[model samples]
Target: MTTDILIEHRRDIADLKQRIKNRRLQVLGLFGTPIVLAVVLLVWAGLKISFWLHSDTPSAINNILGGVVAFLVLSVIVQLVAEFSEDFDVWRDRKTSVRELNLQLSLAEERHILEARRRTPPSMDRQASYKERLPGEIARLRYESQHYRRVHLLMQWLLFVSSSAISAVTAWYDPPQPAKGVLIGLGFTVTVITAAAGYFKPRERAFNLQQTADSIEQHATALELGIAPYNAMEEASNLELFATTVEGLRADQRMREQQLDQPQQGQQHVI
Candidate 1:
């Protein structure tokens, strides 16, 4: 019964979130149209004024007056369309609906949290949690890997650009004192960045981390589908094998990280 209720609460939360998102879009459209229209009108007015100022034609003033009248007529038509398109009662009740949705969503979330906490002790399913967490772990590792890769590339490009600038400053032309100082600053920056990059080894870290994440994800997928080694085993044995394989992969990754953390000579000794 508690599980069923929790399921219902989960469904309700999802539905509420979707509904809230749709309402936000609707509100954006409702307000955005007027904002866009106003901007367009301002631009039109500015253009009309500019043209009138430069024009020698006597009919220019009359044309401006006609444009103003047209604008007023358009405004009225737009307002009337807006009024007719939506029910006044619905508009008035929108705030109430928003409040109710927020309250219900909050209540549902609270109930879900309470139920989850109550059930957590009795349902201490480590294997279930581990399986559930694999995808998230994979995602996090991939994201971190990509982040480190970007930083590595950025630092490399900065180093190259700074070195090139230093060369150009010294070889191409004799720059002023301020310019020379700036060039010297760039050289310092390059040196510092190079040292940091060498120390961090972002590229190698990214590669190793991504490789580990991919291996883990692949093994998890194979385990789930019962392919190859997993296929030959019973369910319990398959799960044990999967856990052992994943842990072994994780241990290898940790060893790689430890190696990366050490100095070059230390790393060589370890290897």
Candidate 2:
């Protein structure tokens, strides 16, 4: 049975690996599309300005400047879209991985329970020992999840700051007339806000992921240590509880993926 369980786990892991790879490719495509579009638009805008450059009037120069600014703005929007798509893909992959890991652990635990039940009465204490190991496994998973979240958050913040600086420099170099400046400023402000929100949004998710992992670890530890409620439960009941916990985690993970995929109000592509 343990061998069978291990085989199943390996299959599941392989499936997850494939899924993640597919998602990554999809995300690359999503980001790539806007960059291609931006390049095309940029070329078109450049040609338009080149044609306008022949005229010597201030109005002609302003028209060229306006066209250039518009292209820049569109480029920023494309980049934001790409960023959002990448984030969504990453979040979904992480959530799915976590869910699958939890499920695997649960299945392993169930296998242990089954083996213990088949043992002679004198060997029941060995089952308890097996259970004791569960807490450590859970704790390790929680730590890993926390680290992943921290790294992801840091990357996002860096992207936001870099984008904002670029926008600021662009604004300064091309200081527009008062009216135009106001419009450009508004657009810049919107971009900054979106980036800021995107940077911070993952922190909450990180915390939640950590908390859930911790909870599972604690529950497993309690069960193993013959503590309180878990200690009182029969083998069947304990198995049921473990199954339920895994199911809940899976559901939560799916929900998170859906939420991450949902379009945000100010979502924009920056490419």
Error of 2 at 165 (Å): 5.6
Off by over 4 Å in 2: 1-144, 151-193, 196-200, 264-271
Q: Please state the error at residue 27 of candidate 1 in Å.
A: 45
Q: Which portions of model 1 miss their true places by more than 4 Å?
A: 1-125
Q: What is the lDDT of residue 75 in candidate 2?
A: 61
119-151, model 1: which lDDT tens digit per residue? 763322555557778898889889989999999
TM agreement with the true structure for every prediction: 0.54, 0.37
Q: What lDDT score goes with residue 174 in model 2?
A: 70
Which digits, one per residue and each the tens of the lDDT, describe model 2 over residues 183-225? 5665676576566556556665666667777777666766667
